[model samples]
Target: MTKFRFYFPDNKDFVDPNFDGRSNNRTKYHRQYDDDHYPHQILAELPYDGMLVSLAGVGTMQKRGKYYDQELTEDFYFSGARKFLRLDSSEYERIRLMGDCGAFDYHNEYEPPFTVDELIEFYDRGGFDYGISLDHIVFPYFKDEEAKDVAAEKCDLHELIAESERRIDITLKNAKEFYVKSQNYQFEAYGVAHGYDKNSFIRSVKELQEIGYRRITIGGMIKSKTDELLELLECLNRIRESDTQFHLLGICRFENIPAYINAGVTSADSTSPLMQGLKAGKYYSVNPNSIRFSESLMIRVRQYDHDNVQKHIDKYRDELRQYISELQDNNGFDIDLSSAALSVNECVKRLEIDCLKKLQQYDETGLDLDVTLKALIAYERVTNENYLPSKSTESKQTQLKRNEDKYHQFLLAREWRQCTCGICKGGLMNIIFRSNQSNRRRGIHNLAIVTKHKNNVLKSINPAAK
Candidate 1:
């Protein structure tokens, strides 16, 4: 099952109830401060599969003491964040840290120096799991590469891989040693970021794999590279064939999971606690069913003349809550007595909302080619996962053909070609790209045609040449 993790800021200060959900430095208040029990109270209330807290000290360290600079603002927090951070202190939650390893590089750069033993002591004091966010690793600093790279050398593939290895080795060593004692610590390494090259990205993953790091994410801040993303999918598929756990990271959108899931990705991490958090009606959060209704709503709303976006946002939020309420009833939760209904219906609804938001954002912001491909994968996955309601209007044959055509279109777009023969020398010659059964086609052997000269070469010539 895919897991959703809400990032809880670890700040201990009491937040004003009317603080307005905005961060002073660069952080945007996603969840209001609930100063009493940390974010655990919120985490325990929700029916999420996993919990992901950004490594401690990130907010204070990354943009600490910096004034509201628009460029730096956009670099860390997305647009509209400055306003969002001004939330009441009462609405904010204090995040608890279980382990001592700074989970992010940005914080590490500014974090006060602490020995490994101190980190162990923190965990021994009762920590759950510790992980490093790869946001700072794969993404260029401050979301700007050229500026950050002026001082640092462009990440050479070989050199970066070597450096990453030492880091992973240390992490793995710590995790192993820590787990042995505590028996409750989980280890994770984050790598999904947008815009990294195929070679460097894969090399980093390979290094992580060598050091026993699992749970790879695909995109971060909607900036994953298309070629590298597909290659990552391929790598994940191969890993799945060999029986390994794979995870897609920062997957707030619904349409991004199917490729990874079909390729055997075991889980996904997202933060979409409420529909209104990531822009009210837009289902950019992890809700599947919510997005379906939201998409329909957006289409209907677009038909009318609406001036302000807030009206649309409010409308979507209302509709989403209604569906969620209906799902609670369906789940047999006590609608009359129970204050909140958390069930699979709400989960699906939330995912739908996320999908709708993602699609709309892509359309509005000029979709990335890699994201476009990921969206297609999500489409395929949703259909495959039985999330999209089945239609009785279409005959089975029609449905089969449509599905076949979808795969063909994807393959064509990706320029995927199989070998013509065992030797793999010739291009796909007379290839049978599709078959009548379940979209499986015989490649290589099925497509090969023996010419006279090729036959002679196969019989007598060197096997390598053949």
Candidate 2:
């Protein structure tokens, strides 16, 4: 049976939960979290075995150009309600600080970013377990050519073909150099293969194998369709030696992992799960049978409108006050009208500020407050069911659809408490709602879950080996 591993890409501050600032800050200005309270500390302790660090991401984080001076590293500090010194590359390069690199960042560049010697030194210093040789790429379906055309003049077919051949040659040369130099290092090196088509990909793989690489990584598939990527994997599987392993680069969707594994992919890497939690409208949920997506309150904040956010705040506040009065007068409830009104007003004020901030940050121009108000009202209804006034049939139905997945997930977390993961300990609602800490912690939790799932799949497929 083929063994499979999952590698996570380090996309600057996205995958690094220890990133500093107001949680929503996702630019070059962000700094690393302090050592004592590194958000990824829990993740580091998890049994995740592989990491893929992008050289570009590292360069960006270090605020350097395409390449940085390896010897010069610095720590940055942020001053706010929470202030701490950031980790420099020197600090992050330690094995104890970061785990074994299952794969190193190599891309399709005109020139190799690091020479074989420099890469070897880096791998040795970082205590990496594996390294992928640098390679140039020719994107699938002539997308690269199209992109180039958009930037300048259109390339003729002959020119495109020549470019592809040149990329392959450079890749092969880099692989040969790496293999020759890697003899001095303890870490294993995997040659990278990039091509424009299935046959070319197989040819690249064969050439790498001939160059003494038993393991190879497939590149240039990031832009390929799922079917195209699968076809390439199948072709590689057919031609590859029995002992040879293949790593699929940049294809990390959880749903696709099983398919790739089935197609004979030995390992794969992606930053999708973490990225989704941080940037997308939904959070990834662990379900072996199917991929589940739960609504993220962070997305709600991002989608909030500034034009009429005030209207929503006012509407919700009035509704909440009316509901509280109804409960006290009609239901003869012992609700303190003044305190309830004050609480409602305070929440509305906070909601308005949150909405405005999101609007300004995202640069959205619209005036739809209904969805925002509905979400808040739904939460209020859920939390204070008995005291809240019953919704009208139309409003109730609308809210039911909106709240179904969130409510279900919340109940699941509450009842089973099945996930004792670090993030869950903070409360499931925190993971579900909008906040820097909550979103990042949820992302970490998602990583743990997905990694475990991938490992389990591997075990089930290769039960006798372990």
**Local distance difference test, each candidate:** 0.33, 0.55
* Model 2 per-residue lDDT tens digits across residues 38-96: 33455443524455654333332233423223322222111210111122334333222
List, in order, the clash count of every candidate structure.
47, 0
Number of clashes found in candidate 2: 0
Question: Relative to the unseen true structure, what is the C-alpha lDDT of residue 360 in candidate 1, on a scale of 0 to 100?
Answer: 42
